[model samples]
Target: MRRFASCSLILAGGLSIVACTPDQPAAARQPVFEDVSFRQDYSKKYSATDTTLALSHVATDRNGAVQILSSRGLLQPYAGEFLYPGTLVADKSFRPLRDKKIRAISTYRQQRVYLDDKAVFSNAWAGTLYKKHTLPNAKHFAGGKDFSFLVSDGKKLQYLNDGIAWEGSAPAGLIDIVYDARRNAFMLLSPSEISVFSATEHTVTTFYTGKGLTCLALTNNAREWVVGTHAGYFTLDAASGRQRGTLQRKLPCADLTAVEEINGKLWFGSVRGAFMIRPDGKCNYYACKRWLPSDTVIDLAPGADSSVLVLTDRGLGEICFKSMTLADKAAYFGQQVRRRHIRHGFNATLENLEAGNLGTGTLDDSDNDGLWTCMYLAAEVFRHTVTGADDALENCRESMDALERLYTINPMHGFPSRSFERRGYKYDSEPWRRAEDPEWDWKSTTSSDEAIGHMFVYGVMAELMRDEDLKKRAVVLMDSLMQHVLDNNMYLVDWDGKPTTWGKWNPEYVNARPAMVGDRKINSSNIISMLQTAYYFTHREVYKEKAFELMTRQGYYENLMRPMREITTAPASADDWSKMLSEAWNHSDDEMYFLGYWGLYRYAFNDTLQANFREAIIDHWQAERPEKDALWNIMTAVTGAQQFDLDEAVWYLQEYPLDLVSWKVKNSDRGDIMKIDTNFRNQHTAEVLPPDELEICRHNANRFGLDGGNGGATEYSAGDIWLLPYWLGRYLGVIGTPDVVKP
Candidate 1:
């Protein structure tokens, strides 16, 4: 669950840094990928939160298969039992793609490495590189506060933390370091380089001479490691420094850039493509261009413990690591089945899909298409939910609770509908201001509380796919929102005797003349989606009727979906985040656009969205969009390269990087409201912070919430997590499970 940072603006009082300078254009940015060294360094950052975060160098799936992304932007599928989507990524990218296609995913657990704090040293995230803040450094830090960046000088591990150093030695040519919980030593990997150095044995006595380990990564077992080189891919003994076996790839000198052992087999990537070498000497290869993208392999990355990111010359991509294996897939299937049963009603799922039921009710659920969307996903999507795993049911429960809290909230204090229940309603910041009125500049008529709920609602549903009880509750909650809207005709808009509710920013854009809509303006967000799905499974009229009615009213999409669906990118300015987080920026071309296309897509897999409105969205995207850096641009480039077309959404992702602000405007600084004004705020969190508060904020922004919680303010927050459930859901799957929706 994420911390709901109050969007309340303080409006004054704080050390605000103008993040961007007016001298530069709003879209200005540098190329992130232009630097080869940087591209090769994607593995530098380890975040359990990054679902689509990519590492282009080496990637794999749950089945220990490899995925080789080509230069042309196509995805290559491998022949192996994949337990997850992309590859098995861990704090260590546990396994690389088994040669561009077949990959392996880990059933996460506490991989304890017995480290002899005295003899050998290793950082959990990155092998020991420097002293981290404290003298007797064991401090687990997150965010940039104590974020460790490691680069080896090829002999010993050097650490950098708070201007101090914690030095430790490893085997000669120690290419990779693994935490050995059993011996409490750092295991080094190189062809002939496996040594359990006790701070005394800096050199290796037992070296597998025949191996030339060029690339290395850790595995689920801190005691073991995945090693790749010109010789072949293989896993080695950490304690004994013995070769387990040669990974069975057919390539003469398999350029195994990545490797992971899962389901009792080996997976690795080479120059030409990806491959999976079974224990029995069988194999599977995922040819880059032959399947999708070009043949050039670049970099690979793994996220948290969930998604796998693959970086190529074009852009980055994400895939589930565990979904590629038989065990994890079976486990994921069981979890989804349980979740489906837990859902209050399966019919509700269909009802929402066909009818649409969000943005128009007292009981709010931001992700309108939850029902059908969940249906669109594959069973393997819930792989992380298997009974016993890292960040398991506890994660799902906490996430659901946060979403429920979001729905019950009322925002803007007493100036508007201060109550948490009707929290999203806005007030007349500037009365007599009307979109139709010539003098009416777009003014804030309502709070974006509802808009931001997209994160909570979508996150809840995503958690449901993995958790049973939460999934059922989520469905029922969606059903209730739809019922509320149907009973009240105008789906949850602030039509309280007002002619229209004016808005300034769409959820994803900012600065330009803001857009306004009638109080009845609604879209598919807000859990209304469960209706169609419910109807489909139950054959109930209420669900279907309300869904269609909601759709008819919210038919004209707004700015939210545009950015929500826009190619993903990091913000270039504070204004950009504010705009992106506003309801005014929710500019979807139109509801009917995706609607018609969705139907068409069900039948025709290659259908393209040519609606004039979609084109308009592209125009709007380009007009107000900012430029991106190379790393960020890689995403857009992939989109451009994949869809075979150049458009605004793709371009934004491919070229924009957040601008550095010199002038900071924090929501809490100027806020005169109760400290609760701290509600719905941005930047202000950084302003009001004492050293303690800053420490907490640092926690909120880390790879995973190690302190506060997964969704802590300084840990997990609704804002960042929102991007994962909503946008990623579409690209990944909806209720349309991969097996069931292949239709």
Candidate 2:
């Protein structure tokens, strides 16, 4: 998906600037692709404290309903609107099975069969006891064609047909039983080999032999059986019972514990997690609490819908796949933002979620409230520009009001506060300052990242929003903020008339660090962009003059144009501030740089500076390729680059987990990745983990971080984390409209 650049000629106040069109026609834009179908995971987690819910096996009943078995009894799937739990089978009116400890279960034609120590029962026969056998105990059961069935109790195996019990040459150490309709036989699995009991011949024969075998399942095509072992799994010839190939173990998880073929795909449950092998030979791994109640999977089964049921020791995980487009996902996240994340018109997090329950969440404040609101407001602005949606416009207006309040709530001249809260409720104590209203307090010591983010959105709103009121307000704020810096010697002076830490853009402060330090390049880049945006909107001579002086006289141009590769750890002789800043790559600065690129390139004083800024932006994006961040890639598309990793961008979007709860996810103990020694960028593995496989985080965090979360204590907002990149991609024509397709 590549497109030629489409430019909009803007003539404002006797100045001309050409910017990328956000609402260009599809005919002039090449589509990313015909919005194809992708898998979206939905999980249901159970508590770990309850022993009665310790499931061991899962299978569908005769009515195609899921039934899980444990030592206590059976349970069924319980569903709700968003998040839900499971239900006890006895509560669903299974009176005869209320208190019985089920050992095995099977589904026959129009009947659900269960077995205990000495009796077999059927739900379709209007009686609990369908037959009585002399078996001391039964643990595994399966049904063959007609009334044929088999039962095993780890040592003894027996066959039954039409109520006649026939003794067979039983194999010791029996582990499981499955019926092969293609062969009209019963397959008995042990630790080392498989045996087939031919119902017609009334004899047992060796089917296949293997070591460390645990479980097996017949394929939907009826041509092969997938056999699982402690190491991995392999396919078997259904007719000849011959092994297909060497055991294949290269997977997201080895140590296979159970296997099931559902919907023409092989699904596996390992000691670590569960995975489904798609038709492309790639697996979609489901691990961590995000996708399961526990990582230790016990069994797998086909559920009522096209979903798969993963039974773990803790509970059941039902993963349903839905066909959706990026536009559809944006709409879903839009609703999610409004429902739970909005706090006083600012896009905020829902914290203190008890056990990942959304109903128990409370809207919380953050230190980057202004930055978060800027990104969310920009998303709505792009959405409204693309579709003219009324709700998007209203969201933009409301969030913009909150942003405007950041400036007015504090008494400091043109200094925007980081966030505000009701009196005595300020979460953090260090940086809070009382407001004149006597009922509120606003955060002080706002950093350079917030400053750049505010300027970026103000510039975007001024150029793209259709409402004149918003446009004028954005211009006024842009000028006021820039004037504050210009009047304060290129620094954001706080109430104490001193430069705040990380808010120093003065030449003396920025150039004091070595060339390799990131602050040198980031500060130079941000200041120039801020100055350029102020000039572009206000048409003031002072903004242009100040920008020129910094670029030519102060050596800021060379600093900003430095190659991204040159940024490394500061020398040992450097001061503590510079060394600490260069200890690892500051990903937060990446956020600031990309946000500043909007103003850096779009509102450049001339095309020559814009061209150099394009190179800088692309260089930063190249360094960030391993992360495959959707927002960075999409923002780099603003430079009209042909190859911005569009495929990887789509992967990032599609693989993003729908549940944004900050659940504790551990991937450092995984066996699939090739861990490496720590480096400057903290690259943990050869390839970064997929979005759903890792803990949910914001764009500013390192994507390579292996393990992090708050243990289901918080839920992050999708407004800035997801919607902004999606809408920005749509605005720049890197992503196309949703295709009309069936789910």
lDDT of 2 by residue, 1-743 (tens): 12225544554433344533232323244336456667677776544345655577777755667677776677765553345454334334576677665787766664567888776677776663466556767787787776667877776777766565677556778888888887788888989899998888888889998799998998857888889988878889999988888787777777888888777778899988898886866677888777788878888877766878788888778888777877778888899999988888999999998878888988877889999999999999999998899999899889988888889998877888898888988744668888899889888899899999899999889989999999999998888888989889988888778888978999999999899999999999999999888887897878877877788878888899999999999999999999999999999998999999888877776555677788999999999999999999888887777777888888899889888988787778666677999899989998888898888998999999988998889989899999999989888877878657232
Count of clashing residue pairs in every prediction:
213, 0
Candidate 1 lDDT: 0.31
Model 1 residue 699 lDDT score? 11
How do the predictions measure up, each by TM-score? 0.27, 0.93
Model 1: lDDT of residue 680: 21
Model 2 per-residue lDDT at 96: 64
**Lowest lDDT 10-mer window, candidate 1?**
35-44
Off by over 4 Å in 2: 1-31, 46-49, 62-64, 79-81, 86-89, 99-101, 109-111, 125-132, 239-242, 739-743
Error of 2 at 364 (Å): 1.6
